[model samples]
Target chain A: MKRAASRLAALSLALLAGTPAALPARAQDAPPATRPSDDQAEVLAKVEKYLELAKSGTAAVRPQAARRLAQLGEPARARLVELAGADGAGLAELGPQVVEIAADFGDAGLRAALWRVLADADFPWRGSAARALAKAPVADEGAAFRGLGADHLWQVRFAALDALRALDLRDARAAVRALLVDQEGAVRRAAAALLVDWGEPGALRWLVEELRREDAYFRVPLGAQARFDAHKRLTELLGDDFGFRPGESPATPANAAALARLEAAARERAGDAWPSELPPIARAAGASTGDVLGLELRSCRAGEFYLRWNDADEVHVGTGNAAVVTLAPGTVERLRAGIERRVAELGDTRFWGEAGCDLEQYRCVGADGELRTWLLSKGQASEGDLRPAPLDAVAELLLLTLPDEASADPRLDRLRSRARAALSVLGGAL
Target chain B: MISLRSLLPALLLVGLGAAAPSAEDATVVQMVELNNVEYQIGDDLPDWVIALDGQRIEIAGFMRTGTLEGETWFDLTNDSCGCGTSKLQHFVRVTLESGTTSFTPDELTLTGTFAAGEQEDEDGFVESIYRLTITSL
Candidate 1:
């Protein structure tokens, strides 16, 4: 029994480090006396190769390396745990990978290490650690997991809920129930789904209402994606799709019929337990609604920038780091006219040159409420002679709207320089 | 002797006349159709997805990046941010036949030849179940 416990611990540790810990399950099912001896030299060589790959391989290669390393059992687990416990640079270099791999084991030491990592507010891999804890839940840590449910980051809160679900403690139900009111739509959906999974009545109403979401971020269909996720969850919990197609508009006759059938099914299942008239689905924070024009620039290395202007002449800028600033007015009309003229000048040529790391996307809502999109390669103007004047002008205007505090950001400066260089090449003024 | 350079102008004119592929020539595949399924290692791909193998296809997705430097190959995923647990089925491995490209956080529309099924690497790891080969960007 002690040996089995140790093996479980090792498995949890491996999982925490993001390594495949299934090898330990095989070991646990069989007696140690009948275990086969792996060739020492072969094991050592394989460990070295996988460790190197896990450390520096391409994104696609790293997960595979972690799996292969975990298959080596004790040697790989020991090495990962040691690396995870390292101080300073050594820990920083391999902390995420080690924590992911160590999650598979139920070893007290591994659990303690993960707990420490989870508690560290400054740790970059706290989310990973939180997820690892979920995979190998300890009854004693229910309070800790519950505490994480209230974390500021929705990702952490979601991870905490997952851990509580895995732990299956009776008291954690209220904690999970409270998150249904979470500000983030994703988290609210997750909380509702979890409650439904625990056989709580009336939670199904939340997902049903979510199907009508039409919220967007310019051209990105965030609400549709959310609706799809909700439908997927509903289908899984109910074991029926009810002929619902997420791609179709919710108001379509076919979709309305399908949703009616789903609602009937839910009502039948819930019997007298279903709640009457659930609260309306809330739009995600900062989602665009009735915006006249939106422009976004995504830099491969630098990050993402979003600018949205409404008919109210309100210009909102999102730095993609959760930082949003409202700029002073009076520039919206000039910017809109400039963009419209430029768009007219560059007709039907949406794409230019080859694909690059940076992308510029423009979205505008027409009088008929139709959304039109123009996607362009941000590096194309500099790479080739095909000058996209609209993209350059928009970039310049977006930079110009930055408040005094955001002007010092290096990313904005790089964008400003690029926009100026392109305008200078075109002999155009902003 | 006829020089190939002499034929370039006519070729360019012909290319300009038919620069973009017609809609009917390529099937538009969405990432949700591919990703919204439960799949495990060694599980056979669904028949509907298998039907897309070797077909000319257009897909829009975000490029999953490990580094900012250019690469000849990259993974295309439905999720812009790596928030959820990624599996082999969650992404399609895309290889360029010509020049390399770097990571782009914005959505990209790519036209390519699609291949489906498990492809294992030299070390016996399943690299990806879906693959795409494009002649250009």
Candidate 2:
């Protein structure tokens, strides 16, 4: 996998270098005209200045830099593409802004570089590349867009739909329709909105139904955001909100009435074409029982870990792949009660620390079957002293449940030691 | 029993009382409210959001950073992927008043005094429309 990724990265660099064979056929296929020496020096200075600003300035300033680079025309763009090639690993960090700059240029060479990034499976910014590709003219991109629409990551698939919409490729209707049942709720909503724009009135049912969704990752209200996005899209496209307020709890009587009115309006719009049954609401994959509690720590560079315990005295633990082990009788009940008490004392805060690339996510199914979630930065727990008290205690308890034989596994042993150290700092026994 | 070490910060804040805002005093704000509006550089922010200026607020979001070490400031964004059009309104530029924070991959809750309005840099580029100043992690 590493070798394959390296080769793809190299190929992307080659494309950016404007190798003759790598160039796509377009009316503006010629390389950007070279500037006079003094003008070249001036452009180079401007590029250096903007690139430095993009690196040091506020994150919002990166877009401004991208605009300035776009205004500098092709020499600056060639320099950026060269910089991207020299530091392939930094591409993930710089890809979004660089791609945005490329999107503004009418240069075919720049678009070709985007295609290479989009095609490389290991590229971290494929979604950004896909969205950027939308601004440039499309030529044999239908197959590529369709393939990206089926990418494993919902973000990539979502961006592909957006690209198709921007390109106004009405011929891709079948491809968009297939995504109405996408596994991710947000993607499904995006697909529905796109199809509705294509004059498919029946697709309005998906948006109407999404307004009533209450799916959550613990207490995060992910579904609420999805509903909000759907509502916003519907309002922008149709200019009528039907009184559906996304901030209100979906289960509230007021939202229920609003949803009914929205559904009626959708049905009227669909006329005889409304489906007899709506597609099932998409949900994240996991155990949904009220008796289950799961913690997932995901670090893209370091790998991922998951621990799940339930009422049946079963504990599932894994890094990458999971193993289920039955715990000692009555252990689950005791641990669950203790953890519940600690969580309650932690209060209503749903997330801790500022966002980063790594995550420490805790999800527990409450007695009422509502999933309550808490999120903390994984780095916050890297040190024993800084680990959140409630999370440390819960993690320690869960670690203790591992049988003595678990120590035989190196990964499990490391986790156990880490939890032990954290608990000790809190003056708790494991 | 809760650890005294973990409770020290809250205890110290209580001991100080009205001298500063406690964690409990921070109004919990949702990222949705800040990002719901599509804002350009020169456009006026919604009145509801502008009302939050200088108020102690707590908000949750993912941090965007190029590095994980010795960072005194970072951008907090609602979406992790940062796909679609990234306008000036999409991020809240957070500056720590004292110590720096390392980057973490999980969702974070930050409590601080918020300033809402467009602020430009030397180049006339809008740096951020919303800003936050926090004392510590």
Best by lDDT: 2
* Model 2 TM-score relative to the real fold: 0.65
User: Model 2, range A80-187, lDDT digits (tens) per residue?
Assistant: 555555334444556466665665656565577777776676565565676677655476787778777877556678778877887787898988988877655677
Q: What is the DockQ of candidate 1?
A: 0.08
Candidate 1 regions exceeding 4 Å error are: A1-38, A86-91, A95-97, A271-273, A276-430, B1-22, B67-70, B79-84, B102-105
TM-score of each model's B chain? 0.78, 0.77
If you assessed candidate 1 against the hidden native complex, which CAPRI class would it receive? incorrect
Where model 2 places Cα greater than 4 Å from the true spot, the runs are A1-40, A52-58, A81-94, A283-430, B1-27, B56-87, B95-112, B134-137
lDDT of 2 at A122: 53
Task: Give the best candidate by TM-score.
Answer: 1
- Model 1 Cα lDDT, one tens digit per residue, A1-430: 4444344445444434455445566645666454334454456556667877765555456667776777778766655555555332233355344456666645566677777766665455566677777776788888998998887556678888887888876578888877766645677778888888778857887777677666566645666677788898889877897887775567779788988999788777777877876542232333455577776655432334556777666655542112244445656666666666666666765454334334456766655665555665533133444336666665566557655433543334444455444333322334
Every candidate's lDDT? 0.63, 0.64
Could you tally the backbone clashes for each prediction?
A: 30, 11
